[model samples]
Target chain A: MTATTSEPGLRPVQKSRYKRRSKGRGNFEMWSWVFMRGSGVLLLFLVFGHLFVNLMLGQGIHAIDFAFVAGKWSNPFWQVWDMLMLWLAELHGFNGVRTIINDYTEKDSTRWVLKTLLVVSALVVLVLGTLVIFTFDPCVDPGSTLSQCK
Target chain B: MTATVEENTEAKPGAVPTFEVTLRIERYNPEVDDAPHFEDYRVTVHGTDRVLDALHQIKWDQDGSLSFRRSCAHGVCGSDAMRINGKNRLACKTLVKDVNPGKPITVEPIKGLPVEKDLIVDMEPFFQAYRDVMPFLVTTGNEPTRERLQSQEDRERFDDTTKCILCAACTTSCPVFWNDGQYFGPQAIVGAHRFIFDSRDDGAAQRLEILNDKEGVWRCRTTFNCTDACPRGIQVTKAIQEVKRALLTNKF
Candidate 1:
């Protein structure tokens, strides 16, 4: 049959032998792209706020001793801030690495393995971080010099 | 080099060894056939002959019915791009000696495109995608009396994407594009990148917004097929990555 289009000015559609493959179920990739930007913006503030408080405030980098950290963690506000920073940065970093892995890895098993390690590592950091932030008691150490601990 | 040429010419005399190169070209006549089929034609070619030259010999000497597109006979013009041995390449650029000289070379229209008769594909969809991205420069305000000045760094930023000749090789090679026709292939993305990163162009935000759709830049899985298929050796994947980064940070 001669290549012919029923509609004028339109090219004839040659049926491809290949089957149509969907990227994924629902709008995962779309949300993934949006998350990168949204999380990235939030991360900028969280990260910078963390650095400014730790490095540039008061005695600057020299003031960041064990007592300084203990003093900050004594307040619930700092606990929440640290919590947000940990979660957002970890998830953002995870997503970024996932994208890189997807782009560079050639084999399916390699991608799966790398991604599994990524998610596992992120979860480990998240769980340990959340635990330390919420459950830490500086008073437990008898030799602690922190006024807030006393 | 001159002595070598003279000695070779003297040794060969009037006879230059020529061998038969069979072209199993895909043939489809929309006027009559419902499906496509391969038709083989044997053409004599020398070592330096390109696939386009072989096609010319076939069309001129063997059968006038053979149909293909060609211009400039070099890599320019972006015409006569076809699949030679399952890979998209410019027919004018592909030397026969490099692509299976002893066996029949399979010449077919590029994939993910509608075949229009013998080796030509319907390029309407490809061009439509290119047009959809608004490939031209979009600037606001009155036209400046002088040319829009751009820094060397700014020019270098998007220098790679500017080499696109509108060849459908990159687009047709993409598996995502083949699976889904609606997705703007790397060709269109590269075109948008050409303008999106242009320092003088005020339309980067607009173009980025246009490309932020569901079927837009996000659809690219970074298979690197487009980069591999590009005839100009343009960094197609790098351009796409730059576009993606722009979308994320709102900066090109």
Candidate 2:
């Protein structure tokens, strides 16, 4: 060890050593970050709107029942709203949890297992929720007393 | 005089015990060596002695070639931040006895920064990020005749982030920063937060817009490594979270 002498790899930092390509399929991480903020903002509206309509609307909490849900889903407008909410909320939440797993899980296998479970579970919920929202039928039974059926 | 000095040197009841320890320091001389290697030094130190003291002893007594940085010899200047036993810490703040007493303490340059020589790393990139955040207060008003008065509540809002010392410990410890050097690391975000939350500052919007870039606060993965490595005990992860929330809420 000497006090000071020659230039090894120690050159002036002209440009950043960080080599991030501006364009590629590798832009997934960048898009993921963008999606978090975008979906987060969208979710605030969708979630609050869903809440306002479901819990605090004309009938309020007291009016909620199986038939009340059937009536809302009967409308095409509600179907799209619910579908958008389901997709955005699930993907947003899944990405958030995936980030968390990446941060905490040091073991490669543990991260792989946890992320796999998360993606599978989120897909399951998204597929099921979408089916329920779009394919829902209030008149499944001909003798049903629901107002939606009548 | 020698007899009196010997008598005074005797340990008192509450005096901490001294122990012989080894310091395994990573040595890299770009002039002389192609690759880095470790040099071990045996030094007898009191339990209260900091790791910096051991380095000083080695430089003074053992090998004059040994190179490291120290200024205040206290934690305030943040000059001697390095990896001690696989963690970033201020050498002056870490007591030898506290970090694995009997084992050899390993000292190396902080990770994610290019080593110029020995323990000193090039801090230009780190400071560049700091500069990008605009760490100064940016109020638009004319110079006040009197001091700009802040209410107690408002002052306290950004107090935690105000303790930053420009030490790259938190920034270098972050895996995100380690992996992607382009990302404005935690230290920069903490600096931005200092101004972003200050009630008297008018630059919050501009700073927030700057941070909204792809490699800004969103790059933080909340590893808690920054929080853990902070010598000032600043809640770095919490500050990052607050900034993230601000990005969406558009408020403090």
Interface RMSD of each: 12.0, 10.2
Looking at model 2, residue B71 earns an lDDT score of: 88
Q: What 10-residue stretch in candidate 2 chain A is worst by lDDT?
A: A1-10
lDDT of 1 by residue, B1-252 (tens): 011122244456676545677899877788887677778998878767889999999999988988988877788899989888888899999988788867788887887677777778778878877887788888999999998998999999899999998878898888766643667789999999999989888898877877776667887877788888999999898898888888778632
Q: List-wise, what DockQ does each model earn?
A: 0.09, 0.09
Model 2 Cα lDDT, one tens digit per residue, B1-252: 001012333558766567788999989888888767788999877767899998998999998888888889888988899988888999999988787857788898887778888899888889988888798989995989998999999999999999999889999888766643767888999999999999889998888777777667777877799999999999999999898778778632
DockQ, candidate 2, vs. native dimer: 0.09
Clashing pairs in 1: A1-B32, A1-B33, A1-B34, A2-B29, A2-B30, A2-B31, A2-B32, A2-B33, A3-B30
Q: Reference contacts recovered by each candidate, as fractions? A: 0.14, 0.09
What's the TM-score, to 2 decimals, of chain B in model 2?
0.93
* Docking quality category of candidate 1 according to DockQ thresholds: incorrect
For model 1, how does the per-residue alpha-carbon lDDT over A33-79 read when each residue is reduced to its tens digit? 77777888988998899999899989899998888888889899999
Q: Where does candidate 2 stray beyond 4 Å? A: A1-15, A18-150, B1-16
